[model samples]
Target: MTAHLITGAGSGIGAAVSARLAERGDELWLLARDAGRARELENRFPVARTIVGDLAAPDKLSWALSHQELPDRLDSLLHIAGVVELGEVGELTPKAWNLQLAANLVAPAELTRLMLPGLRAARGQVIFVNSGAGLHAGAQWAAYAASKHGLKALADALRLEEHDNGVRVTSVYPGRTATPMQVKVHQQEGKEYDASRWIDPESVATTILAALDLPRDAEITDVSVRPGR
Candidate 1:
């Protein structure tokens, strides 16, 4: 069975991807912020394993993972967990910027650095679940957009850096997927939530799986998922 580690497997796109992979008998390793969350993930994915590493504290991820056992070789590392807080340039505080940057950008980079051995061993793939904001920043989305943009840069650099090692990197940019994150974004925008109008989480999952399942002879670098309706 191919083994993979996933962050943010609790809900939304992360949950959707986990469910799909689990159904196919893939060995899963889920990341949780704490022991309680690890328990929750274990319950959710009965056959999978769990690791406790708080993305909020990116600087401490090395220390935390040092105490735990990680996979010797991983087929993939999915960077799916992220936090978002919307505010304009003048209104967004340092706390908000740091929160988004730490979780979405710094944490992923640190985790990737720590997992390079396994990734290199298996010639793994790194998938970043980015947002459309990563490509284009609009009004009042400064901090979140900036973090995502940085994530894009990270992916780009990693793809080239790891090319000779046979590790692939892909960034999937989804447009307004109907997940809890979308609901929160709507709440922040002070708009009514309607799940029907946006792209489905499963759609994004399918996109991710396609990238993962591509033939070794070719690799997909970037994918953009937009709402069809």
Candidate 2:
């Protein structure tokens, strides 16, 4: 069975991806900020193992991983955990900027580094669930955009560095989805939360799964999914 580690496996796109993988009979390691959420996934899918850690806490993350008996080889590493802090550059606070960077960029990069040994052993695939903001920043999305842009760069660099190791890195840029995060963004912007206006999380998850289904010799470097308005 394919072994995969998925961060932010609690909800939204992460949850969708986890469920899909479970149905495919893949072995899963679900990492989430909320242990309860991870447990919920495990309850439904007996093939899942749970790891709870605050990604912002580097020491805690390392400790948690060290304590676990992770798979000896990992087929896929899905970096789906992330946070968004929205504001124009002038209005962005230091805390907001730092949090966004830590969660969206630093955490995933560190986790990838930690899993590199296992990934290399299996010639694994690494997928980053990025944002359209990574490609272009808007007026009030400075911090989020910057963080996602950094994530894109990280994926690009990792792909080039790991090519000789037979590892594939894919960066998936999905447009705004009907997730809790998007609801929060709508509220913050004083706009109504409309699911119809956004792409479905399952749709994005399907795209990721399709990429994973490609032949071993084929690699999908990047995918951009947007809702048609």
Candidate 3:
């Protein structure tokens, strides 16, 4: 069975992807903020292990992964943990901007750095869960957009740097998925939450699985998924 480490595995696209992988009998190491939710996955899948903590803090993240006794080499590292703080440039504070950068960009970079050797050993894949916000800036999405764009840049850099090492890096941009984060974004806009209008998290997870399923000789450098109107 393939061994994979997934962050933000408690809910949303993270949880959906975990479920899909379970069906295929993958060994999973799940990192989530909620211990309860992570443990729930352990109950559902015999191959699942739980690591509960804040992914944004390198120390906490490192501690959790170390304590969990993960496989020495991972087949894939799926980074799905992120924070979205929406605000116009003028309204955005240093704290808000920095938090978004740390969680959405820096955290993933740090985790990937820590996991690089194992990924290299296994010739593994790294998938960054980015957003359409990375591609275009909206009236009140400057901070979030900036962070995601940085994530895209990070992925590109990693892909080039690790290509010779046989590690594949992919950045996936999903547009307005129907996740709890979207509910928060909608509430900030004072708009009624409409789940039907947004892309399903499972849809995004399926795309990720596709990227992971590719032949060793083939690489999908980038993927963009948007809901049908």
Q: TM-score of every model? A: 0.99, 0.95, 0.93
lDDT of 1 at 5: 97
lDDT of 2 by residue, 132-203 (tens): 998999999999999999999999999999999999999999999989899989988989898999999999
Tens digits of per-residue lDDT, candidate 3, 1-229, equal 6889998776789989999998888888887666777677677666788767675575567766676665689899999988887777888899998888888888888889878988999999999999998888899998889999999999999999999999999999999999999999999998999999999999999999999999998999998999996
Q: What's the best-to-worst order under lDDT?
A: 1, 2, 3
Model 3, C-alpha of 138: deviation from truth (Å): 0.9
Q: Using TM-score, rank the candidates from best to worst.
A: 1, 2, 3
Clashes of 2: 0
Alpha carbon lDDT of each predicted model:
0.96, 0.89, 0.87
Error in Å for residue 174 of model 2: 0.3
For model 2, name the residue pairs that clash: none
Question: In terms of lDDT, which candidate is strongest?
Answer: 1
Q: Is candidate 1 or candidate 2 better by TM-score?
A: 1
Residue 100 accuracy (lDDT) in model 1: 98
> Considering summed lDDT, which 10 consecutive residues are worst modelled in model 2?
52-61
Q: By TM-score, how accurate is candidate 1? A: 0.99
Could you say which candidate leads in TM-score? 1
